[model samples]
Target: MKLIIQIPALNEQETIAEVIEALPRKVPGFTSIEVLVIDDGSTDDTVDIARRAGADHILRMGCNMGLARAFSAGMEEALALGADVIVNTDADHQYCADDIPALVRPIRDGEAKIVVGARPIRDNESFSPTKKLLQWFGSWVVRKCSGTDIPDAPSGFRAYSRDAAARMCVVNTYTYTIETLIQAGRKRIPMTWVPVRVNRVERPSRLFRGMGEYIRRSVATILRVFVMYAPLRFFASLAALCALPGIVGIVRFLGFYLSGDGSGHIQSLVLSSGLMAMAMVLMAVGILGDMIAANRSLLEDIRARDLLGATTRRRHDATILKLADAS
Candidate 1:
């Protein structure tokens, strides 16, 4: 088995080399270890530093596409490089490199296809009270959506087996941490978590423009994932909500009409009719959304097959070339 440690970098010229050099040179059940850096249009010397630190692969983007894009690119490159497992870490060096082995242990032992490096969010001193509350609330929401009991849903430290990597498709441009956990749960991928250590704050996050922007994007991403995967439930709940009020309105209208005040209850009839019409519309929308969700699932399957096939063919071609060289 081969493992590729991938770091998504923006402008970490100072810490990128340290992050790369700190990676484990060898791990059990892996024949080789390779370091990959995704330079997302870094204007600094990050690429140079990573190269100097002996990164086996560096994927440079045309422009700054954000962490999600850089992460996806690194995963694709790693898979194409015949990596059996891929470990992703931040370039800021906020996460401890020493915990990488424990992070990937479940994957190596065949217990999980994806492993999340859970961090002690409560014990972190860098987090403010508001930040800590938001973290806990966001993680709880993600757990409900993903059906996974992950403590640190926002942590970037994670490991994915080839199968899990191939199946990954990130639609959110803001972040991959939360969206991926939700996706894995909905897709029924075998995922687990391990406690990991983190270092002190090295630098401010470059991913978010500000706290408000981060909150907006995070909420949008969460809602998108929920609606995309559970459209029927989402729409049906709204439909039922409207229907309940419509039923109550109709009952009140009936009571007024039976009391010989039918003319006075005309407005109630109109309101009830409007509510019922809205309920019907929402139901129709729910069905349409459910159909679209099904089509999306089929597309995901096709994409996964394509990725797995490409990886397999790449490995096969490399093997043939090596045999020819030996001959």
Candidate 2:
């Protein structure tokens, strides 16, 4: 088995070396362990330092893509390079390197396809009160969208089995953490979480500026997930919302007409008709979106199978080459 730890970096020349050096060369379940550094077009010397710190692979994007793109790129590279299990951690060393074994244990034991590290957010002294509350709320929204009971969703530190990693498709450009979890849950991938340690972040987050922005962005991800995975449900809810007011207006108009004041209720009838038309349009949209979602599911299944097969063949060929060399 091969385990590859991937760290996605931006302008993190300060901590990339420490992050790469701290990774363990040997884990309990894997014979080979390697470090992969993904430099997201850093202006600094992140690539050179990561190489000096014993990084086995370095992938540099042509331009400064966001974290989400960087992560997706590294994941694909690791899978192609025959990583049986992949661990994703921060470039700033926010997650403890010693805990990598625990992170991969769930996947190794066949317990979960995806395993996320649950940080002690409430007890962390680095978080302000408002930030803590926002974390809780953002996680709550993610839980609803993902339908998974994992305690933490915003934490980027996670481990994925080959199958799970291969199946992931991240459409969100701002962040991958929340969207990936939602994708896993909607796709019915087994998921679990274990408690992990974290170092206090010395610098402010580059992801977002304020807690309010966090909530807003998280909700946006939820909406996107809902639209992508559960489009019928989302649009149906909207149709129902429109139907309510339309129904009320129609009932009011009927009551007035039956009471001999029908002339004055013309405006009410017109409004009800407009609302009902809107409701019908929304319902039609929901049906069309559901059809598209079904097709998307089928396509994703085919893609996943093809990718997994390619990865498996690569691993097998690599093993044979090693044996031939040894002989």
Candidate 3:
């Protein structure tokens, strides 16, 4: 099987070559092993350095689009290249490159379609105490939402089978790590995580300005994915929460009316009516959202099928051409 390893780099001129050099040159795979570098609008010598470091493919972006978009682009190129599997790692070389075989072993064994390299968050010396706690909390929340016991939800190191790679669609521009897990879980894609080692911090993360910003963006991504995946359930539960209390208050106001002195309870009636109206709106929104989600799913399926067919045709054509040349 042809396995392509993708590194998403941005202004990493200093360390891009080191990251590329550390990559394993051989694995127990069927055939070729290639390196694909995604240059995310680097103004520096990152592209040139990567090229000199023996990168098989360098997909360059005109401007910085963020990690999620770069990842999506890399996956598209890998698919078009007829890769049997794809592995993603950071350009900072934070992850241990030696563990790549272990990372992809499960995929080779048919145990999972997607494999996440879990980090020892708490034990990492580079993480501050607060960062450690935040990491734990974030991973816990992701575990609950994803129904997968991934200890490192934000790790950039991961492997995807060709089928899983084709089905992946990163809508969030913030990051793909958490969003991909949530999508795979919601879609019932088989996933597994393996423990992996991480190197010391070479540079601060450029993805966020600070921990506060990261938390804000991460929470927004989680909520957005949840709504997109299960809009009806999410909004219906919210609607019930508002409407149930309003119904109770309205019933109490009716009792007050029958008792002769309902004038004092006018405020309660107004509040109840407002709440019921809000609940109705939420329910309507939920219904509309469900319809939109269905349409999005249909479109996603169509796109996946089209890409898969194209990849297959390209592979067949390449084989026939090779055979003709040989003859």
- What is the lDDT for 152 in model 2? 85
**What is residue 254's positional error in candidate 2, in angstroms?**
1.5
Best by lDDT: 3
lDDT of 1 at 150: 85
Q: Could you estimate the TM-score for every candidate? A: 0.97, 0.96, 0.98
Give candidate 3's error at residue 2 in angstroms.
Answer: 0.7
Ranked by TM-score, the better of candidates 2 and 3 is 3
Over 4 Å off in model 2, which ranges? 323-327
In order, candidate lDDTs are 0.91, 0.90, 0.93
lDDT of 3 by residue, 73-160 (tens): 9999999999888999999889999999999999999999999999988789989999999998999998888888888899999999
Candidate 1, 28-94: lDDT as tens digits: 8888999999999999899998999999988999799989889999999999998999999999888
Query: On lDDT, who's better, 2 or 3?
Result: 3
**Clash pairs, model 3 backbone:** 1-30
Q: TM-score-based ranking, best first?
A: 3, 1, 2
Query: Where does the lowest 10-residue lDDT sum fall in candidate 2?
Result: 210-219
Give, for candidate 3, the lowest lDDT window spanning 10 residues. Answer: 24-33
Order of models, best lDDT first? 3, 1, 2
Q: In model 3, where do residues sit more than 4 Å from their true spots?
A: none
TM-score for predicted model 1 compared with the true structure: 0.97
Local error of candidate 3 at 267, Å? 1.5
